[model samples]
Target: MIKAKQIVKKFESGTNVLFAVNHVDLIVPKGQFITITGRSGSGKSTLLYQLGLLDKPTSGDIELAGRDVINMSEDERTFYRLSKLGYVFQDYAILPSLTALENVLLPLLMLGLPDADARRMATDAMVRVGLEDKLINYPSQLSGGQQQRVAIARAIAHDPEILFADEPTANLDTETSDMILELFLKLHKEGQTIVMVTHEKDYAEKADRIIELADGKIVRDETLRRN
Candidate 1:
């Protein structure tokens, strides 16, 4: 569903150019759950931003579903992202004032979905993430895990072709993190395409494939046995 060739993202600091993401090539097939794992500065998140169209690569090409996204204008990219992609950040990016259901409804409403249809979709998404009962709760009223589930529901409400999660379990405890990972696993089983960036090997192991990064390059790509 996504392909990147010789992707490079660089930043200029004084006279030195830092390659946040060095020359990298990747392909993510439809319905495949992949994880990118590396140390803090290994460019795992940088590569993800490039692939997810959240950031443009300094050089190289990115193709999603066979169309080149690197050349799209900012407005076009925004539309594409809203229509086709979903994201979950390390921090639950939910609004403090919005109810969980309303948070999920925002994107759908942005897509011009009717209020009633949006509500139904949002409710379904919340249920899928085990947050059905927390729909009316505000972010501050929920636990960390519940807050993250609302974020997840918000991301998936539109049935995006692919879901991108960047360090999604970073803020939770061990048990909560496990629950979140299990939720991701459940989504994968339901054929949701996912590309997650995580520092934990244990979480990465749960994915269909794990791509390890080092110095902004892919050092290992392993396909795990799906039991």
Candidate 2:
């Protein structure tokens, strides 16, 4: 779960201040699948970065599962991010030299889990993403969708409480994109809390909630009913 209040992320552009995210307040409950959508410069990805703890807001408060995270030390933030959050980006972000299983296990190893434990978790995560057969393959050997699945596996290896994805299917073909979305839906049905930023309206509509942003502000926040 996340709660943000009056989040302002401003940048100095020459003499003018550009507000990428201006006074945005957002709440994402546990087990919810939410999509943030907007045109270029609309601040959807900027908002996601703030919520994902990848960047700090210039002025605002963010609570992640009830802990105040905005003021945490960098070291503390790193540990918390490793422990509680998972992330996927438009780029696969997979290491080129590492095998799929190795990539998935590295984060768990970084978390200080024993090798055996990390290995087990990593394999399970790969399986969850339908990549069990491709564990030994490197990013170069896999298809774009498979590589993305490996990235997802890496993110979920530690069983993170929140998964943040930014244009996760941007590089894939339509069929592959649909495959990724279906995987996300399956995970959500099993209680994963996902917050994804996408420019595609069809993908956004599949979520439990859709948030539309314009010029750094929320213009439409709609919660869709699931069957």
Candidate 3:
């Protein structure tokens, strides 16, 4: 599903060049749930951003579904991001003013779907995330986990090829975090391709593979088991 080779992301820091992600190569096949775990500032998120096409690497080659992604024009990359990728961040990334259903359907509308189609798809996504009853609730009206579920619903409403989560459980309580992790596991069981960045060891162990990074490099890549 994704191939990245010799990826490097550098930043200028007071006349010094710092590599946030350095010489990393990774491959994620279809339907694999991969967890990237590392300490703070280890570049795990940086690598994920590059792989998810949120940020282009300073130097590297990235291929998604076998098409080279690094050299695409800005518009082309934006189109690909909207059509092929889904993201869930630690903050939930939902608009507070929009209701749960509207939050999910808004992007579908942006993708040019008809209002009826977008509404139906949004409802289905909410159902999949176990949020069907809360569709009309505003963000401020829902619990933290429910809001995050709404975010997840939004991410999958259009059936993106790859679902990327960056520290998805960071802000929730333990029980809520477990619930969220289990939800991701359920989606993975149903053939969703997931790449998640997390710090919790037990949660990270649930994935098909674990990638450990440090100092902008992969220190360990372990397969806990094949799913």
Candidate 4:
């Protein structure tokens, strides 16, 4: 449900300009799990950020659910991000001071939902990620996998249309990474729209579609069917 056309992003360092994304065009269909794969400095994260409306392109256009975001006001973009998107990071990005359930409820709180209803939604989301028993646990009390599940729960608590994950398995061991990817696959089966940015090809290959980035451009795009 997202479309980008000839997106370009550049950063300035003193007198030099570095292009983070160069004339990239992409479309993320609804109900599909897509992955963007690239090495460090390949601009995968920049492209994801632009897609999520967290950042704007220097010269390009993006549309979400048929709405052109490049022309939206700042507040409009902010509202859309809060209402339509969820994010997961390699670091988990959970509040250390909050319980898993509470962390999941953070986004609902921002939406001004009643405390009881938010907690219920949070609990349900945590359960969906297989973290129901860890609701009362703090981030430090949980394993890396559990923490990532909490992040996932938080991201989906509001039933966002799209989830953007940046290097989701980078901080975990191989086995834990596998579990996380499996969880992602499960969510996709449940019709969650996801756009993941990862350096791991195995993870990207697991997605329904893979987009490869190099020097800020998409060099390859492939679609696959799972056996």
Candidate 5:
């Protein structure tokens, strides 16, 4: 679980101060799927980055699993992120030169997993994402959806406690996007905590809760009932 209190992320322009995320307080429970939705410049992505520890807020407190992370050192934050968090970005973020299996294997290896164990975990992740046949394929050879799946495989190979996705379906077609969302939903059902930022209303509806923001402030936080 994660908690944020009075989080404010500010940026200084030439003569103006911009609030990327202003006075935001949120709590994400374990085994929950939450989506942050807003129009462009609404601070949705900024808020995601802050919660993911990819960026620090100007002022606020963030507690991850009851540990204060707002003031963690760079090395500590890096270690924590690698060990406890997973991320999927809009851009796929796959290494073009690496095969799908290798891409997923790299992160597991970084965790000090032995080669055999990492290989097994990476292959299982690829299979879970329906990319087993394409494991040996390079990113350039795979379709956009396949590439994104590879990215997801890499993120989940280590089985982190939380998954953070930013506009994960932004570049995919409708069918492909649906496929990806289904995969995410499956993961959520299996008890993976997820926090995603997206502009698509339809995708947001699939989450357990949706937090709508405007002008860097959360205007509505709605918990949707699932059948």
Candidate 6:
């Protein structure tokens, strides 16, 4: 569902150019669970941002569901991102003042859905993440795991074709991380496409395929047999 060819992303601070993602080529098939693994400064997050269209690449191309991103207009890019891509971040990017249900419904609001339908979808998503009881809870009231689950619910509430997770388990305990992984696997089995960035080897091993990066380049690509 996503492809990148010789993608390069660089940042200029004064006179120095730092290549965060250097000539990285990646392909993630539909309905597949793929993990991107790397150390700090290895370009994993940059690559994810590029794939999600949160950041523009300096060079090369990104194709999502067959359309080249570089060819899209600014408004088209925004619409595409709003309707087709879902993002989950390590820091649990839930709105501090909004309750869990409201946060999940935010994407639907962006789509201009009616309030009733938005609430229905948001409730379903929260239930999917086992957070139905926390619907009225704000970010400050939920634990890290609960907050991350809320983020996941919000990300997928729109039923995006692709889900992008950056360091999804970074802040959760091992048990909670395992539960989240199980939820991801369940979604994957039901044909949800996922691209997750993770530092934990155990989580990486659970994916159908693992892509490792170092020094802004892919160092290893392996398909793991399901046990």
Query: In candidate 2, what are the lDDT values of residues 1-227, reduced to their tens digit?
Result: 99999999999989999999999999999999999999999999999999999999999999998899999999999999899999999989999989999999888999999999999999999999999999899899999999999999888878889999999999999999999999899989988999999999999999999999999999999999653
* Model 3: per-residue Cα lDDT at residue 207: 97
What TM-score does model 1 achieve against the real structure? 0.98
Model 4 CA RMSD to the hidden true structure, in angstroms: 1.4
Segments of candidate 1 deviating more than 4 angstroms:
none
lDDT of each: 0.93, 0.94, 0.93, 0.92, 0.94, 0.92
lDDT of 4 by residue, 53-92 (tens): 9899999999988888898999999888888899999899
Task: Give the per-residue lDDT digits (tens) of candidate 1, residues 113-216.
Answer: 99999999999999999988998998989999999889999988999999999999999999999999999999989889999999999999889999999989
RMSD of 2: 0.9
- CA lDDT, candidate 3, residue 153: 90
Alpha-carbon runs more than 4 Å astray in model 6: none
Each candidate: how many clashes? 0, 0, 0, 0, 0, 0
For model 2, which pairs clash? none
**TM-scores for all candidates?**
0.98, 0.98, 0.98, 0.96, 0.98, 0.96
Itemize residue pairs with steric clashes in candidate 1. none
The true-versus-predicted C-alpha distance at residue 191 of model 4, in Å, is 0.8
User: What CA root-mean-square deviation does each model show from the true structure?
Assistant: 1.0, 0.9, 0.9, 1.4, 1.1, 1.5
For candidate 4, the per-residue lDDT at 121 reads 94
Clash tally for model 5? 0
Clashing pairs in 3: none
